[model samples]
Each structure stands twice: as C-alpha cells, then as structure tokens.
Target: KSTVINALEDLSFYCMENLPFDLIESALDHLTREKNGPQRFAIGIDARDKRFVKEFKNLTEKLRKKFRLDVLFLSSSDEVLAERFSTTRRKHPLLDVGGELIAAIQHEINLMQPIELAADASFDTTLWSPHYLARKAEERYSGADLHRKLQVTVVSFGFKHGMLKPADTIFDVRFLRNPYFDPNLKHRTGLEPEVAAYVFEDPATDIFMEKIVDLHSFLLPAYYLEGKHYFRIGIGCTGGKHRSVALAERLVKDLAAKKIPNVELSVSHRDVMIGQGI
Candidate 1:
C-alpha cells in the first residue's frame, strides 16, 4: 500500500495510506481546507483490512457526497495470483494467520468479496503487463480529462507474424512498393531515412496515406463525441520492418500536425525486430 501511494505521489496525486474508516471524513475536510491541497488525491487501503473492507460502501457514499470519487478494484485469477507470489517470493498478508500460500490467497479473496461487490469498476490483471496496467489505471482515473481526450495507439505489425488484437482500425500497406526487394534496404528498418524514403516516395503510397488520414480525421472526432476513450490503429505489411513502420510514423505525424484538441498519440512497431538477433 505504501509503494502504491508513493507511485501515485510521483504522478502528482496527493496520497494517504491506511487512514482508519472513522477518520476518512475528517481527512477529506482537512485536505480540502489546505490552500495548496491537490485537486487529485489517492487513498490506498489493503483489502486485508477487514474493518475498512466491511465499511467500504458507507464510506464510499459519504465521500461521494463530498467529492467525485471512483473505486477501482483490481483482482486476478487464483492461479495468476499464486504465480505472482511465487515469482516475487513475497509472503502474503494472510500468511501471518498461518496458512499455505494458496490457502492465504483464498482467504484474501474471501475477505475481498464484499468490496468487489461494491466496486464502481473492476479489472482482471491476469494477462496485463505492469506498464499496461499502469496506463489503464491512469486512463481510468483521469476523470474530467477523459471527457475531452481520446487516446490513439498506432501499431505496426507484420502479416507473417500474426494480426494485432484489439485494434479499432487496421490498414494494410502491403500494396505499397516493397523495400525488402532492394538489397540496400532489406537489412534496414523503416526507421532508417533510406528505407522510409523508399516506402513513401511512391505515388500510390501518397494516395493511400491521404485516404487513411482523411478517414481518421473524419472518424476520430465522431468517436470522441460518442464517448470513445481509446482508439487503436494497426498498420500491417509483409514484414513490419519497412512499409508498415513508415506509414505508421507518417500517420502519427499527420495526426499530430492537425493539432486535434485532447487527442494523444502513441506508436509502436510490433514486429520491427522479428528477424534481428537479440
């Protein structure tokens, strides 16, 4: 809980950990009274705190009456939780009560049942990477900023490697001239100036990119207005090293140049190093 609070503090959120249930109201009052108090705050409580867990609903109601609050509950399958404990070699809080690791996990899960039922939102972290989980948490708690913002993740992938999942939009750049055919560019990636020039210099490539940009420019705003929070755009080619990477880069640049308000862009070349030796 201290670790989580520290991380939130680093992100500029005023944080408190393990405030007793009885003091929550006073804590809020004190925070709001400070001249330099943070507009955003995070309070962390362990699920193992049975007293707090039992009173969570009432506490949540009281807090909601005073401020906009969100309850984010994170959990994972038993197997995943066990694996995490194994990898970290950390003792579970329930282990202090005298039980095996799996038994401790089950005990904790049982204790958290009521809180889970009362959560405003819940996430299963079984398959999520740490970075992905952090990104998701930030996005979820961004509050009012989410109303005006749309996150765009542009991914460049290779057809041979497999399709990217969870893509809101996908563009195939295979029809564009292949840079792999040129021995000079075969070993180079689209990030290289020579490879990028080769991929984008074709008239057909220009027309394709223009069409894609036009479509996205038209659709992105509509999606945002319709309450879409995140958009994933996948660009694919025979191999992710060249055409897809160049086009994804160009698309991100064009989107940024538009200066579309509240739109954040991120790009990744998923298969850029598929054949490169680690």
Candidate 2:
C-alpha cells in the first residue's frame, strides 16, 4: 500500500498543471483513501457504433459506483472512417442514405463529451499503437486482487533492540534465564536441544508462555472481524539468542499445530551473534 502511494507521489510531478485536476487530485488523495488504500479502477473501451454511443456512455457512467472508470473515445477522420466503413460494410450509429461516416463519428464524439470530461484521461486510438493503448489502459486502471484482500506479512525480527517498527503487538521472554552463561551450552543456538531444555525448564518461562499464548489466542479472532489481513507479532529477549528464539519458535509451532489457516507466523533472532557463555 505504501508502495502505491509512493509511486503516485512520484508520478504526480509529471502531470499537467492546468488539467481539470482529477489525476493529480486522485494521486494526492491517496493519503486519505482509508484502510484498503486506493480505490480500485477500470478502463473501458467501447468499439461499437456511435449510434449507441450515448447509451454506452450512460452505462459506463453507472459503472463508476462499482469501479473508478476511465473511458476512451476513439475516432478517425471522415475520409478515413468512410473508407474503412465501406471496406468493412458496417452500419454507422447515426447513418442515413446520404450521411457521412466522418460526421457520425464526430457526432458520437460530441455526444460522449460528458463521459469524456469526467474521464481520468482520453486518447485517440488512431494515433496510439496497440501496445501503447494496452499500457495506457493498464496505467489508468490496473490493480491485483481487485477485491484488495488483506495483506498479512509474516516477518521475524529480534526483540533485543526494540519491537519491529510496524508491529502491532510484542511478546517479551526476558524472564527466561540466559543460556549464554551456561558454559556447556554457551556455544549452542536456540535450535539446539540443550538451549531449548534450559529455557523451557524454567517455571517462569512456562507461565509467561501460557499467558502470551492466551493473549494472542484472544486477539487474533478480533482482528479477523475488523478486516485486518496483516499483523506482525514481535518476540524479544535480552539477546534474542535463547529465550526470544525459543519462544518465537514455540509460537510458530503452536499456531501451526492448531491449523490456524489464515494466520501467518514466523520467527527471527535479532542478536544471535552475542558471544557464547558470556
């Protein structure tokens, strides 16, 4: 989401200053777009006859409530249009026995003024390449997961320094004794059974883990109802080598063991480099 905002801010500088200001305004308005971030939009290109252009324009306008819409109005010169229509033998929207194909195209363009003016951008397809047209459509309206599903990023960070910058909750395991002081186990990591045993054997560690687990067990369900799809829970200890790592691993295991399907869990050690047996 932040990436989208940053990209828009960077693009805003290249926009024309005198335009009706929708593009620039939309870019700037990104800051206030709310929980799901920027609104989803779509680009609509109608290649039907201008005869029904008015009706099509109205239909596209009605789509605005469902999606931010960008309409492209394509036309060609009268001579060129007539040559193509005659070659293709297609009926014109406002055609008559003596009607000019060019005139009908112009009339369609004129009738589409309301939609064009409301559009984020407009272009003449005759002058744009197919690749360029596709790119333009993408630029005006392209977003993955158009439904904007919540993005839950599972990150592992060491707690010795501080909680993660974007973390909503933090768990502390500092009460567990330091395995660094155990001469026989000092060189081992939290992944080793020796270190794990030392940490898990402590009564305080047991109580702390239970309480923290309960807290998460309570809070996660509430987040689901609030439409939150992302959350980072940080686990920290004095050095992030023993207690923190062990607790983080345990949390991951417990959550996984329960088969908590939409939730994500990961663990990382922040200060695993601290000298052993210190």
Candidate 3:
C-alpha cells in the first residue's frame, strides 16, 4: 500500500538534502492509499543506509492486514557501486561526511539482514537497468497458473536474418510468386489488402494456406503443454517485400476468421526497398 522509511536521510543523507520533501510525502501518501484502499502493496527496499530497516519492517507489519505485500529488496556490492559512482562522476553519500563511500555501502548491506530474510523476492540490481527491472516485475506478476491463453504472433520477415527469436515455427514463401517484380506494386507493403490479393493469385498459395491452417489447428493444443506463453510464427521470403509480407497479413486474417483466441499476429518486412536504401 505504502512505503515508510526511517527518514529521507536514510537513502543518502547528502542526496536527500537536495531533494524536495513534498515529492517524497506525496509518493508515500499515494502508496498508503493504494495499500489501504485497493489492497495493492508495492514496496522497494534499498539498503542505502543502516537505520531505515526499522521503519521498513514497521511499515510492512502495519500494512499486513490490508494489502498483499510484494517486497523487493535490491542489493549491490560495494565495489560495484563505487565503480558506478566513479564512472558517472557522482559524489557518494558519505564522501563529504568524513566516511568512506565503500564503508557506508557495506554498513547498509549489513543492516539489510532482517529485510532480506523477510523478503518474498531479492534481486541483485548492481548489473541491472530500470528497464530490466520492470520486465522482471511483469514476468513475476503475470500469473501462469490459471488457464493462461497461448499467445501467437505470426511475424513476417526477410530470409536475410534467418528468423525472429521468438518464432516457434517458420514458413518460407520464397518459392512462391513475388509481387516485388511487378513495377506497379513494387513500392507497396503487405499491409495493403491489394498486396495480399496479388500474392495469393497463385493456386499453390491457396493450397499452402489450407494446409498451414490445418497444421496450426492441430499444433496449438500441443504448444499449450510446453508452457509457451507466446508463439511467433515467422513467414519469410527472399527480400520480405511481397511474398512474406502478404502471407503474414493473410495468415492473421485467416486466423481471425477461424476464431482463434490468444492469437495476436503482426506483419513486418525486413527489407522493402533496402537495396535502393528507400
């Protein structure tokens, strides 16, 4: 619901002295409201100083009744933070207080014993960026226990890169008739419904579609067994300008028509006018 620290100085005495207290108060108030009103508990435990552990523990104890606490404790080694501070050209909290920055960090880590022991999850944030943290949080929160629908993303790409990483299966359309050779349609992408019509004019394309759809219908239930949250089926051609792109768009439409749930499909051309650098 909310976070309550010992004091602003608990993070970095030097750092907080320059920060606006109003902002901190507002954040705490927001956290409190979320915890008490919505049963949402979001708390961050950073052992920047040794004294804040008491307040952190007290806050958790008080909010246990209303909110389900998701406590995250971010830890780092003294050596790592020291190197980071040097690289960033930033002053350490204890540098001006007759204390070694490394010593202060060690002291903080030592004081985190209680919180770490009590944490639901602990992460080493020394080498992690904020983006990575957010992703980790999302992955942890996305509950897989209750009938998680298998997500399928059918992406169209170029053979130049081989395949997209998330693709569970790949289909090649390089052998099919390509629309890129047509001067009138060369500039267009697969998103235009006309492109799809032009590419699917070949009788072989029609046969291939019927088969692929049949195959996918059979494979989806099997894929669910592997705990696959998302499936990216790549369709690639030589340049991805016409065949691959058109096929991808058509695949999404067909999948929709068949009433496939948990399927989020998209089309991409890795190269459209790449040779001319357009």
Pick by TM-score: which candidate is best? 1
**TM-scores, all models, native as reference:** 0.50, 0.44, 0.47
**lDDT tens per residue, model 1, 1-278:** 34445556667788887677788788888888999877778887765677787887788777776776766677888899899889988878778764788888888888888888877678788898776777677665555553557899899999888888989999888888988889888888988889899988899998998898889888887666544678999999987888999989989999888887668998999999982311
Instruction: Give the C-alpha miss distance for residue 154 in model 1, angstroms.
Output: 1.0
- Give a tens-digit lDDT track for model 2, residues 1-278: 12223333443312222223224345434533667554432222232333334455455444443333344444445566677668879787466623777777676556666666755445665555446655654564345324333333333345545566777887666656878778887677777777888989888877887786777767765564443556777777665567666777777676656655456656555566662323
Model 2: CA > 4 A from native = 1-163, 274-278
Candidate 3 lDDT, 26-129, residue by residue in tens = 45456566633432223333444434566666655544434334555666678987787788877665564438877766766667778888876777767776
In TM-score terms, candidate 1 sits at 0.50
Q: State the TM-score for model 2.
A: 0.44
What's the CA error at residue 62 for candidate 1, in Å? 34
Ranking by lDDT: 1, 3, 2
Error of 1 at 222 (Å): 1.2
User: Could you say which candidate leads in lDDT?
Assistant: 1
